[model samples]
Target: MEVYHLYSGGKDSSLAAWILERMGYDVKLVTISFGLLDNWRHAKETAERLGFEHQVLYLPRDTLKKAAEMCIQDGHPNNAIQFIHERALEAVAKIADRISDGTRRDDRVPFLDLPKTRSLEDRFSVAYIRPLLGLGYKTIRELTEMLFIVKIRESEELQKADYEVELRYLLREKGIDPLGIFPRRHYQSRVLGWKTEETR
Candidate 1:
């Protein structure tokens, strides 16, 4: 079965690609570049290292700028980050449609939550598969090691940059993890602006 995997060059996505290939499925990799210097390099190297045919989708800067503005105007709880993420997903979904889906065209987008950002992009047509959800970061490391997969070296620009750490730092500054106020998926909300009410 032919399937297209969203390639982020992260441990999770890399491991997902490895697992899918081992399962006897024909998987192609697609990476969307939002013009982030660090992200572009990472995606390029990961695709080459794994020897998978990869394609790059360029995202316009204005799209991101507009998303950021919408977040601020709408009082999106997280700010500009979430907007960027949603825009990326939307861009990927559009690209995914252009690619032919052989067997897995019905695959669905896996979201940490049920709603909110669920429909930001259409993953079904791309046959998006989330094979790494059952696996943790440590397991991903072990698999890469066992399979001799080369770990992606972070660019010097991102050497000390950790988005999760940055998120917590801001939460600390705000004196709130805001769990009681937002849904679980919004754990990244501090980084991505979408906010969800717990009861909803």
Candidate 2:
């Protein structure tokens, strides 16, 4: 069976795709862009490096705008991000019978709880899978290290093509400084490619 993995060119998503592939599922990386930035190309490149078929899905721009507004209203990025993630899940459900993501067990934001996940499955007749939901930070990082090379940095330093980057852009367009809303210390990763023999 084929699984369309929502990819962000980050460590978690990359690792999730690898795990899914190892388990015998054909994994195709899909990056959702709300038409704010062309940064989704970062994920496309990383997907190629990882040897997974990849595509960019241009979604409704209103979804991005609403999430940005939610950030300003809520004074945090968590719920807004989760809202966007849920929307993405719903949209992808229409494209394939199976949808997957990199959301981890410990991740608080952009996650689907049991009830919500089940609801999505029931309503869309789709199988929602997040392979990393059972894996924590250390285990995921260790496993990623064995399979791929990644670049890690504070999110401010132009990290991977995660949604936050575009969300921050949209927030700024709405006259709200992202620094005023988003946490400053958050770090993210970008998967560069597979680890060659010498590096591994």
Candidate 3:
């Protein structure tokens, strides 16, 4: 009954965890850190607001560095992002019987295709869950608003701890500026707290 959800302090992941908890699972929030940045505290703070047990899991730094290199070579971050996400799932699966993420139906990067999803389940002997997979942007937005207060900001704002920030830092270390490599106007949500006391 314990489900360890990969959390990022963002609306999608937050809603996913909330829904899983409501479904009778003991949802514990988890964030993956590649040891590149110290911003994981933001996620911890958000988890506190959500009233969920939270923990941080560290992934191999070398893989993240490799992913940064991938960004420069590929001229886009889709493959690198997806690579880190899948690796994160595998990392969590090692200590989780049920693993979940906030990826929605419209997410392009950091998405697990059907084959990868099945492979993850079979290889790890763990159930991978995506509570928002069947929900689109509009519905997820409405659901989040009804249950929690969220703030939307550009991805560069870094209100939440996520893999992209780490990749950006790595790219910078390699003398490759991340300003143009990643999209400029990408926006994400940060769950501040519950809009209603009863929901919390």
Top-lDDT structure, candidate number = 3
lDDT of 2: 0.89
Overall local distance difference test of candidate 1: 0.47
Weakest 10 consecutive residues of candidate 2 by summed lDDT: 154-163
lDDT of each: 0.47, 0.89, 0.90
What's the true lDDT of residue 170 in model 3?
86
- Better by TM-score, candidate 3 or 1: 3
Write model 2 residue lDDT over 7-107, tens digit each, in one string: 99998999889889988999888899998899999999998887889998887998888888889999999988998889888988988989999999998
Highest-TM-score candidate? 2
Per-candidate Cα RMSD to the true structure, in Å, reads 11.8, 1.0, 1.8
- Over 4 Å off in model 2, which ranges? none
RMSD of 2: 1.0
State the displacement of the C-alpha of residue 80, model 1, in Å, after optimal TM-score superposition. Answer: 3.9
The worst-scoring run of ten residues by lDDT in candidate 3 lies at: 191-200
Clashes of 2: 0
